[model samples]
Target: MMNIRRAKPSDKDFVLDFCMNTFEWGDYVYRVWDRWISDPSGLLLVYDSSNFPSTSKSIPLGIIHIVKCLGDILWLEGLRVNKIHRNKGIATALLKYSLNYGINNGIKESSALVSTNNFPSQKMLEKLGFSKFLEYRYYNINLKKYRDDCNVSIKPDLVFSKKLDIKISQFRDIFSIQEYLSNPEISKFCVSKYFDSWRLYDLNTSLSSLSSFVRNKELLIIVNDIDEIVGIAIVKPSGKISFNGMPMIQISYLNCLNLSIFVRVIHLLLMNYCDVNLFNNAHFLLPVFAELEKILSTKSIENSDRFFLYSKFLDTTSNLSSILPANLQ
Candidate 1:
């Protein structure tokens, strides 16, 4: 027999053993295990298998985690199944359980990120009714290499030649920032959501949400000589350590007036926000733009990987049978 239950502290070793090689670089499950287990707004589940006598203990076969974000978004992540138990419906069961939990808790939508190369996972998500909403690529920067190759003292010629008078400063004006984000053009660029700390939140431009960013001092804005907002960058410490034990940072969202401005903003961020002795690397989750790609290539920065954001709406008024299979229903 098999069943799913809340993950316990005792399941750490067993779960981590299988999660070690989830990808070429390994997995992040271990890094987030504690946070996921302790998160009150999230659920960490383990699939237990029992085939022995009644007195024997059930063994963990798989794991899944779901986090409730602002705007009633359910962020699903960390789905892993033991190699020996592959193709036995373990992943499907875990996903269904998490989805049901979200529905019961008033979650309106569900989202997950998958690698562009993971066809199996993509097929599974399609089978489960998720649609590919957006594509993003990770542009990784090596702080030490970047600092050595590029002179940060001088501004890029592109921005300097344009003679665009701009300054990079911390953004705190919640009202104005909210108003700026509400523009249809900006909204289209943001794609109605923002990535932070590896989780996605609806870009509703609500005062409360923007205030949280302000409190953390993670919001940066580019303003012209007249102090009009021209660009924005949402960056924060990832609370994760690299393999070499250095700290990691994430560029959650970035938008600028043009390619030159965008490049300038990135250089400014490297000079001001990223301290080579402090941060080891930064990961940028950016929308797929051809011009941006060309500029990044010129800077010797290559995309590490591409990912697809999948989303599905869960109707609260409908029965589970309408969306889930009979067994799950």
Candidate 2:
């Protein structure tokens, strides 16, 4: 019999230990895995029965991390089974539990990403109910090595500073990006989540949680000749951040295209939006990504990640296999 339950706080250290002892994910993310407890999303645990045949240790068989948004999707990450217990049914049991948990929790989709060379893991995920929808290419740029590249200065009517030195709180002052996504033109260009703004480092103290929060936390709005908002951009310090250990940039609201006699504001942030010490994932329109890259390549922003317009589907026969749903979390 296997025991699966919500991971307890005390299990944090054990979970980290099991993962570090079982797999290899570079030294950086290795340590960061333990910090995931702060996530308001979801995280879980896996344990084996009398099968491992151990004497003194209540070693965990595996561990899985999850993140959830308002929708029915959940992201599964950091799935690990101790090397000493590989051949057993521990991994299989963990997946089954997660899948069952998803269906019960109103989660329509659950998913994850596996490297091309990771054969056994790929086979395991597919066998459990996952399918590949896309392949991601990762890249990186050293800020100091290429700082001469940013060239967009066509300012908006409003510029949300990268430093949160100002205190504006009204809707006009602090316009949440998600609130603006309903606008037809704006929604089309949105490649991130509504609550993503809430997840920025401005709200957290951990450096891993910090990014260009100092930059992108401020919202910018640009308008056309008629005062209709048209474009928006962010300015982030050159750094990186990700759920687990991916690289990213913290970009602040730059120039919005048009439409604004009102104020644009932010709640908190502004330590070092451009601090060379962190990482962030300032984004561009999904389509603009390619163009932005070619343009940034000429300058110095390192391109080391794939910014997904992350989506998940749910149903009785949906993509039950490939997703890493936090709901299942």
Candidate 3:
């Protein structure tokens, strides 16, 4: 008799055991387990298979996590199944339970990010009624290589130093940022999401929503000679540390009006925000835009992988029985 239940501290060992080899490099499930278990606005669920005849004691076969983002968006992530338990409907069952939990909590929509190469996961999401919403690519910029190749000085003060026709400055005014994001021309180029502490959030431009970034001093603006905000960058520390033992930072959301300004911002960030000794690499996700691709390729920056953001609307009145596999239902 398999069952699903809210995760507890006792299940940490089992979760970490299966999650340790989740990827080529490793996994971040251990890093976030405590936080997810304690998050009041989120749910961490574990798949219990201890009651099965083959089990002698408590056995956790899988896990899934979901958290409420801005507005009615439920961000789902960290779905993992034990290696020996793969293809047995554990992942599907966990996801179905997550969606039903969201519906009961008044969540209007649900979204998850999956690697472009993960065809099995993609097929499962499609079967569960999620549609592909947007495509994003991760670019990893090596701070040392970037700075040495570009011959830029890594000075903290360089953040405000003028270069060519533009300069980078931290923006703290929530109202101004909100107003800027409201521009149709600008908003169209922006992804509808951002990252905070490795958790994805819906891009909310309201004063209330923008205030947190402002308070944390994570928001930066690229201004031209005339002080026009032509670009924006949101930086935050990643949940996982780099393999080199240094911290990693993410340029969560970045947008610029032109290639020149974009390159300038990147250079400034590598030289200033991303300290070579302090950070291993800086990564960001950008939409699959042709012009952006041209700029990145021209600059010789390395793009790691492509990801798809899948989303689904949860109708409160609809039957969720189809979400689970026929046997599970």
Total clashing pairs for each candidate: 0, 63, 0
Cα RMSD of all models vs. native, in order, equals 4.1, 9.4, 4.7
- In angstroms, the error of model 3 at 201 is 2.4
Worst 10 residues of 2 by lDDT: 262-271
Clashing pairs in 3: none
Q: What TM value does model 1 have?
A: 0.84
For candidate 3, what is the lDDT? 0.72
**Please, what are the lDDT tens digits per residue for candidate 3 over residues 270-320?**
666444367777777666662334433334364466788899999887656
- Return the lDDT, model 2, position 171: 36
Residues 17-132, model 1: lDDT tens digits: 99999888788888888988998878788888763255267778898898888778888899999998888888887787677767766788999999999999899988988999
Candidate 2 residues lying further than 4 Å off, grouped into runs, are: 9-14, 18-35, 38-41, 48-50, 54-56, 87-89, 114-122, 134-140, 148-248, 251-329
TM-score per candidate, chains pooled: 0.84, 0.54, 0.83
Ranking under lDDT, best-scoring first? 3, 1, 2
User: What lDDT score belongs to each candidate, Candidate 1 first?
Assistant: 0.72, 0.45, 0.72
